[model samples]
Target: MRKYPIGIQDFEKIRKENFLYIDKTQSIYNLIASGNYYFLSRPRRFGKSLLLSTIKEIFSGNRELFKDLWIYNQWNWEQKHPVIHLRLSKLDYQKLGLYEALSIEIGILAKEQGVELESKHLKGRFEELIRKASANGKVVILIDEYDKPITDYLDDLGKVEENRSIFKSFYSVLKDSDPYIRLLLITGVSRFPKVSIFSDLNNLNDITIHRKYATIAGITQQELERDFADEIAEIQQHQPDFLGKLKSWYNGYAWHEEAERVYNPFSLLKYMDGRDFRNYWFHTGTPTWLVNIMKQNREYDLENVHIGENALSSFNVEHIAVIPVLFQTGYLTIKGYNSNNRLYKLGYPNTEVRESLTDALLSAYRNVFPGNDSMSVTDDLSESLKKNDMPQMIKALDVLLSTIPYDHWKAESESIFHIIVHLSFKRLGFDVRSEVHSATGRCDVLVFTDRYIFALELKLNSSANVALDQIFEKGYLRPYQMDARKKIAIGINFSSEKRNVQDYLVKELE
Candidate 1:
């Protein structure tokens, strides 16, 4: 049996070589039937390229590959049309400057179809191809990774604008060529089009948050069990805890309002191949341009990333701005959406994403938390909680905080503390949150469990008495007093000049 199409994105390559194809043909049928112009935003390595390649196959009229798939059974293969397949990712996104890159891609498409037209740039050549493709009849246009170039220059506004304008002109041709086009499917990770690249194409439909097509790209757990069932057993037997490990490391993506979650298909299969589940997804694919977003917004909480009473609808990209980047480049995702509220809440989709994010964070910071450090923090935490050794936890926290790498510490101290403590508790398998706000005021750290909720207030230089006074005066404990389970308020002060605790006050609410 052929290996699954783990990284292969070409439909022709996968089918011609007889690779295992995840039958996402049904989604293709629905997508095509629903609209003539559609766009989808999904994370990196979630099979957007493969999906586009499959579309290319359908339009190229390659009927053999579809024979057993759902679309083959359903689509009228006889009605296939000429296709204009433009995959932007195949070109060098970084090296080829914008004008040059788009021009080359246009040349490639023309060359592929034997449409030899000499044009200086994309607009003129693109016009010629659409005109030629239309002479025979309307054509199917599939553009893959449409925003890769713009994402490459996000740090520089001028370059981003320049590329966006170039893309806008290039894609605007599609609108003029629309009457002669049978269908259009544009694939990327975001729907926010800041440059107005697709402004001329008003009929475009964005299925980025559409629940029905949620499983269209990623590997659903059900698909994993059905198609790669034996592989799971193979790994599980070698390590009794493998299934749990796999789930912890590679599962949990919530793209659909209805579907539970999914794993990064690319990472899962790669791990299955090597019998080692690691951060494969981060290794390849577009470098996290989202890091720019995180860096720009330096104080974002790492803990509340995937957990809250409700999903995070706090962010949205401007359609003409670099919005398409996050959607196409694959950092943020449409997790749960509320049509009534017209909101899209985004977060990590699976275990692969979370672990990969942790690794990426460390890499981005270029510093690893000492393994022994986490143990020391835990031991100190236990001493503070169980033995009322507040000074010990405070002193340890000061040392940890002071030793923080310059890159991570460059962020706000609050943000740094949140990242550090959250990473620590994440290793301990507890849900942690920083900056917990109540109606009256906010607590610094809050850890919730089935039996207890710990409300903590940290003061780096303030007196312990002042910290304790604020807890009561601000009514931090009042909010949790009504809970049946216990709630504890901790007031700790750190030495302004050293890695030792100045004082501490701990209290329990009735």
Candidate 2:
């Protein structure tokens, strides 16, 4: 009956209260030994706050807390530094404004350290606090969620710029106060451009994608098996594929291309506690702004996205890219990388993110609320596919398409139709491949169920007979001839005027 630290980010509490603590102290020690100034960008609930908390305790000379940890006897415990920890997410910035809220936070830190600040300005106060706190020794500064104040106001350009400017000026103090700082680590969800926040403080080493520190925050597979063997064994008794299923549901996050994949600790802990596979991490918050951005760009094809290092690294308020935002926010993760071209292949980290994000995107595209209208349509579609009910499937597709508001049809009719169909099938947990290539030709969509394989060709403002003829003429089902499942060929046509499925033909491939 070990206590899982679900939602608990305090290291002292987890250690003192006998909670299950995954020892990440080895990586922490390596981080401190390697550099003094570091910046790490990880998605929310991926244990960024907990990492900072652990570091805070270590610097505060809490040697007893690390009695059984890996770093207990690795180094000298005599050296202690004053820790100035600030979590931007906890600051009342929305109500007090960024400047005032930050001022109050820093003032509180100074009071805790019994140091007096004579400066009235935010930047001056921060510098004064650091210098005074380091009177005995250099201060270890840890700022968690460093970009929350700006990211929370993304929809409002005026407020975003205002907060960005405030942070720029405030953080610049760190550059001149380097002598008083023993170590600095800033963690955030998004990496704003250096010019925005780190232009003056250019010494901060960004370990977000650094290979050595990639597993510094998340729970690795090795750590999972070693730390939670008892819980895993208990779950394995009933479900033979418990570990595999857990990996597919909660693992596959990789910051560096060559690093070992890590699981979302929050989701993993929840699954272990309840012995149920659920989207535990996604339910905590919905990325409404991210969904809106994807919808605006008509970018639904999220798998196998290829981008260079520069495009995947950082973004700012003036220019925001979908892939970087997706990568930074945990919707996507590094799957592959080409060193020659310096291109990274990004995709959904695991089943939880893939399914949950697809549901969100599909709901937004179809203008239907999730679990209300979209869920019924997708469930019906899934049931129809499983039963080989062609007419019912077509009806479900028509209903799904018809729900979209007329004004939302900005993209080309065929493209929009393909996106909706692909998303609908994906939302139902089907294996769907869009624009699949074959030897002779390319199929519009290929769907695979447990007992059936569907090769679909789509035509816009054309006859279903022509579409069916092309599917046969091109031999689209040739690739799946040995798939062992019942192979079916489908040709569908849509009318721009009707804005729904006009007609379709289905044929069983021998």
Candidate 3:
């Protein structure tokens, strides 16, 4: 019966107004006690701003706000630190240059501390503010969305370089003014520290992958089951499987490979508000540009993707790779980490991202938008396979393949076609496994429904019978031979000139 803090980012407002608060004060206490300078990277709307606001209150010696919180008596409230909080998300870096945005904010902050700075440069102005604010005690610096200005210019390399220079000069003051700084916490969406902009601030402890802080921003399963037990009980009175459905939809965001996964706080709260388990998280900040970049870079088909541990967090503004961008931006997450090999296996975190990202990619690369028609395509395929209607299944595939534009077929490789087929079936709620391995060899695509299993082999500029022959010879259907689901072997040939399916052959296993 408590009101959820949907847009309230202020800690004082939430506590005083009696809004629902999932106690994160323990994590805040740990973070503040353990380090002097720290960095945390989380996805947008994942409660980064709120965390910074809470830290601001704690450092400012607001004792009344912490009456019932975990850090109430544990923290030292006698020493009050002047908190200088800056949110880079407020500035429009595209319209106003990066320097001007910093200058304006720094000017206002300096005036608040009863200090005037005549310096026209950003670095000088920032240093003056730090010195003046810490006249009584060390300054607590909290920067939310620290990479917003630079991220706003991701498409323009020239502008990005200019902004990086500005940031490097401005942030270098933190290193020099470390004597007057009590605690510095920087929160952003990405941690591309290899860029020269962050080179001078070398003492920052990046807790992004640290297991102790993984549950700082998002709602852990323990918090969900405990904090919203009443809500769950009420919903299950009508729908018994709501909890399972909710977990499958929005509950698999993992910061560390072995850390406990947490539910997206924004989507979970909105779902509780609407009482519906929909794709609420994906719509918050859709990465349309990410999809466009992936489509442009042909090397990034993103199926069964793996990257080195260093490559996971190592990107610069000048040369940002597709894997790091996707991983940092929350489209992909750490599925598995091999410490011996120093490699990470990345994939979509949950069903919402898997389906929504596929829909976005399908819409970006082709004329066909993902909707009921695409759903019907898979539905038709499922029905055709169940009734043993080979022609109907082939016809359904033809219609689906024809939706792709002709130019895309000419310019892209066979991998694009494979991705389209893979994503199409995946978006339809089928358990699709690309590049699946069997006893002898690997199959191109394997689709599993409730009662049917499809082993599809795709060929470009080759005979359909040849593809079907390879499937039989390699025993691609061997793994599912004894399963209860009916097995179907399908071979489809695509023509580069026609940009559609040229031939199709199918054989059902007895």
Please report the candidate that would top TM-score against the real structure: 2
Q: Stretches of candidate 3 above 4 Å error?
A: 299-304, 367-390, 405-413, 437-441, 479-484, 495-499
Alpha carbon deviation, residue 447, candidate 2 (Å): 2.1
lDDT of each: 0.66, 0.88, 0.81
lDDT tens digits by residue: candidate 2, 1-510: 889999999999999999999999999999998889999999999899999999988888889999989999986788999999999999999999999999999999999999999999999999899999999799999999998888888889999889888988999999999889989999999876455788888888988998998999889999999999998888778888889989999999999988999999999999889988888998798667788788779888788999998888768667678899899989999999999998999998999988888888888887653444366657789888999999999998888777777876653657777888888888777888988888888888889999999988888898888889888899888887888999998989998888877889999986
Clashes in model 2: which pairs?
none
User: What would the per-residue lDDT of candidate 3 be over residues 155-178, giving only the tens digit for each residue?
Assistant: 888887788888888898999899
Q: Which lDDT value does model 2 have at 36?
A: 94
Best candidate according to lDDT: 2
For model 2, what is the alpha-carbon lDDT of residue 161? Answer: 83
> In model 1, where do residues sit more than 4 Å from their true spots?
93-96, 118-121, 235-248, 283-289, 292-296, 302-340, 355-399, 405-419, 426-428, 449-452, 472-487, 499-501, 505-510
Q: State candidate 1's TM-score.
A: 0.82
Native-to-model Cα distance after best TM-score fit, residue 51 in candidate 1, in Å: 0.6
TM per candidate? 0.82, 0.94, 0.92
